[model samples]
Target: MGIPLLENRTSPAGARPAERARRRRYALLAAGTAAMLFAVGGRWDVPLAAWLFPVLLLRFTRTTGPWAGTLWIWAAHIAAAAFWVYESALGSGPVVLAGAAALSAVQAVPFLLDRLLSARLGRWTAPLVFPAAVAATEFLITLLSPFGTAYGSLAVTQHGDLPLLQVTSVTGCYGIGFLIAWSAAAVNGFWQEPSRPSARPAAACAAVLAAVALAGGARLALLPHDGRTVRIAGVSPARTVAAAGRAALARIPGGRQGIAAAPPAAVDPATTAAQDDLLAATRREATAGARIVVWPENAVPAQAAREPAVIAAARAEARRSRVYLDIGIAVYDTTGPAFGRDETVLLGPDGAVLWTYQKAHPIPGSETYKPGDGRVPVVATPYGRIANVICYDADFPAMMRVRADIMLVPSHDWREYGRPHTDKAGLRAVEGGYALVRQDADGVSAAFDGRGRVLATADSFGADRQTLVADVPVRGATTPYDRIGDLFAWLCLATVPLLAALATARSRRR
Candidate 1:
């Protein structure tokens, strides 16, 4: 007879290995959550560079222990999302978790789905499979909700890829996002240990590199620099104080007068008119025989049809100066399908309406302002065909689809840290192979050519008034992005069927 030995056990007071294991699991989950939250809120400017998303997820997901990787990775996403929820839930004004929290949940879906595949699928295909799933998730669901925003999307990593960004003008930003996610996923595959099963991962990494080289070719083919004369306008009809009060008043659905409330701050009687006059001077500087005159958002508050005096002056200026007015003014759509208090307008050189782009994106402080459902149509004139995107519309990748040789962004940013917005917008112009004209209020008003190079810039931030004039080139070549819109996103989406095939093949072999 042989004696049997019992397994070792810890006493109630002792630190057990299981306890430490549990703590590790909890820590991974926490990391995943933190990553998601940070990416979603735009709180961190250099989010990916500071904390590479793929490496973080891979560390948590590629663990050897059973069920450990999934928990840790999921934790990483959830913890990150919670940061966004907690900040908003505790902030000033009313507490709300509707958009921010829901968006966080939406982001977490990919991690949960990825883990399910990662468990059964061989590590060989991690690069191809993982990026595909992520890209698809971003694309298919990007337009899922009525207000789904890719504002903090994973593709933002390509912020440094000026040439690659041009692809968005043709296909849209979602396509660019696909490649970026794939690159990160492929990178993680290379770092995962246990080399015998890492072949497919290497292949995935190859795919990313190949795609980047292809993008480089397209960028090289497009002429990146051109010097074209572009006249821009910067109009400010009201002073800071009057504009503030008027902005507050502009919010309520109105008939120009009889708002039952007072402005946010009293208009400073000393300098309101002086500020408007200063804007007039800047407008003159911008329109002196420039190819196209630019305008600021909400430069004139009066309804377009009702402003005979304002229209007469603008019309006379365009005809006499022989300069086209792309001036931003408020227009009414009393009987239109939708009702908005104000819209951005474009007046022609012949003293007629060339095109009018209603503000598509509405932000806080604008009263009863509804979004303009339609995209801005590209207008062809003697100067060139131009696509007019107003204010918040620049953030959307879909807006890049409208056909135009050049882009005109009319914006007003009195708020500080407006340079990032300008930089991002300017990048979009470069990515799409078009000259970008921006008329800004206290911002980086700029012009960029088709190859994503800056032509001219009014580098003065928070200035009293400024205008930038330079030659705006009209480029015609469509980028690969235009031809292959969101192929990366589509590849990501196809992961669902791919995993099924892998499982079936495994069963058959068995």
Candidate 2:
């Protein structure tokens, strides 16, 4: 009796310490996962971190109880979202906070699904669940959400890895994300079992990833680049000139609210100076052997009554220089809707209006313009087939699928969103097999070839004259993604249901 009592007391005591140790280890893992999430996306991102964080997260979730694991993962996502809002130009208002919280909750669904389903199925099939869930979630968000592919895209982190990024031509952005998530799940399987047999899944996944990289490399090396090239120039008004225009506008009575009451004469002087600067820059670029000249978004600001005159002047400039000119203008209406118009007008070398495209997607909460019809316009030019979209419009992959050689993106960006935004846009070049030229005001302007090679770049903040000139390819390649659309993403989405059903059937059998 005495021996039995002693054994019971000691066993309970020992178990308490073990339980505490387990909880401590889980807490550490949770912390590490949160840190990785913070460092994986948004402004401060490491490509390797994107691949590693999911592994840690999968391991942590699998080891803990379902409810507890979900809570911790959600907490980690919240922390990451908070960090992103802090680091990005997005403000920290209640709406933004609520949005972040909702997004965090939605993001945690993949981890929850992985934790619940990965263990219930066969080891081989288990790894498929998490990646499919992740890819499906991302695809749904991009297809359904107004934000498009602006957030939570794992592909954006791997922008610097051109060879690895080539898979996007067939899979869109979702394929890279699926590969990363699958790698994470496959790696976690080895960590959980740690046997020679357990290593097979991870080894196979490694082989698959290697094959993808090799194929992408082969595509890049073998692609023909002997097509004709066109010299294109992008220009933005000098900071002083843009600032002077803004200052002049600020001096008007009632400021923005008084635009309706203010006469057209009151606004002309402020806008005229900036317009003159851009036209002069366009002329200089054309003289320097550029066949195409583009201005940044909203480069010319005019009252509604004065817009025709502005277009006429741009037309004259294009004819005089014998160059194709693309002009961005913001037309303020005094009598109509409170919102203004954001549009781009392209002029041929013969001074004919080629196309007038309004911005299809305006930055939410920033630009008040009514959205344009989502149709992308393509024009056949002597240089090549050309198409254009405004800045935020380029973020949507589906919207960018135009059969054109060169995609001109006239953009306006803040200092914080400059380079990363441009890098994200470059992925469109890879997916659509078109050269991209982005002219940005108050940001970084760059040109990229279809293979995601940077041709030229200029930073508005760093340069006295914010201009870029590049020899862009005059022919476009046809990609599987451009032809098949989001079939890969849809397949990933379809696999999720099939996987879930299989897991359910297996659990019932057991």
Candidate 3:
């Protein structure tokens, strides 16, 4: 009887206007959300847009049909989120497009699932389902592609909001993500209904967010007493090498004539110049009263383990300068086919080897070296408990979840992705509650405090070599994120299936 009445009530022709209007609304909302995401991304990083995009997307999803929501979300994410990777993979146009499409499709899946589940569970549950499903998806994506970790996630959009960003230290970005998504969903539900049913969820979400903000404020206020300042210097070698090459070519017989007169010096000669430049920068920084001097990834020309002179020269420089020196070099395996591992060695002020760490998480395609098998080490230093990781290791949270006051990262970034890459690495410092000193060979050499505030930055692409010096605070406040490590993400993962099942049963009963 009910089925026959429902069938008689609705006709395709009668519903066309409403359906078309809904579709138009969905399209507008999708476009607006896409624009917001693009604007508030790594380039601009506006926090308000982070909240607005999710709210609009949630409204669109709630109102639109499942298939339409999925298609719209895929299109929007492809244009906004996935396209960011194109800069890193510009060489293969077709491959880049295909990857973007694939990533968009994957990103769309969670939103689609959330819409379907919310339709069954009712709008009240939307707030809970959206964050859980999306977080689970993010965690799964990270498992498949390590780069998928909340490196450039929407949480980063709030980088300028220190109190808001403090949530990362407790929940590893997912906590903030959950709050953002939940607030959006709750607001959408209230705005759509405008009744008592929606009021409860909206108020609940507001209360929870207020609590989070208060806790963040309290954490900031009650932070551990400011520790001693460590004067650190980060040197970029690319500009230095370029400067030296120009000087060398100028001394040649027909230097002003043409490119033909310049020897094939872009390779070995540039490497030699970079090594010399790094050593010079170390000496200069040491003399300038820097307690710690850091070099960019692969600062040495060849394998340091193979050549005793290379290590001897660095040791001599450390001794002469009387500063703690950290240098990144390739360490070759003695037993095999000279397969090298990327490594960073820390030299104490007395020229003694303090700590050595191999790059644990190497870039997949570019790095042809074995990953480090050792544990993440936090060595004690006069400044504080200092830890070191080389280049790609900074991307993985697990590789950096050590108890350290300061983290020294020797990074090498591609020209296009320098700033965002450096910023993402700084997010690690935020999560682990430590100061970061990141020296990049061909990128932005930056220093960030525990609050993820950029203390100093230097451009490695400029004509003149620049070294960044900053007095960075050490020994940050203790964070639950460092202690438990992705617990909030794991809880989200565990809740998704249960929520789906409950929603299905509730819908069946209805």
Counting clashing residue pairs in each candidate, in order, gives 30, 0, 0
> Candidate 2 lDDT, tens digit per residue, 188-262?
999989999889999999999999999999988999667699999999988889988888788887745466357
Candidate 2 regions exceeding 4 Å error are 1-17, 20-31, 37-41, 253-257, 335-338
Q: Would you list the rank order by lDDT, best first?
A: 2, 3, 1
Off by over 4 Å in 3: 1-16, 19-23, 36-41, 86-99, 150-152, 238-268, 303-307, 330-340
Summarize candidate 3's per-residue lDDT along 481-507 as a digit string, tens digits: 899988888999889888889888997
Where is model 2 poorest over a 10-residue stretch in terms of lDDT? 32-41
Note each model's CA RMSD in angstroms.
Answer: 6.0, 3.5, 6.8
- TM for every model, in the order presented, reads 0.76, 0.94, 0.84
Candidate 1 lDDT over residue span 273-353, tens digit each: 433453465446644555467667755554324445555666666665566666665433344433334455566667776
User: lDDT of each model, Cα atoms only?
Assistant: 0.55, 0.86, 0.72
How big is the positional error of residue 454 in model 3, measured in Å on the Cα after superposition?
2.8
lDDT of 2 at 320: 99
Candidate 3 yields a Cα-based lDDT of: 0.72
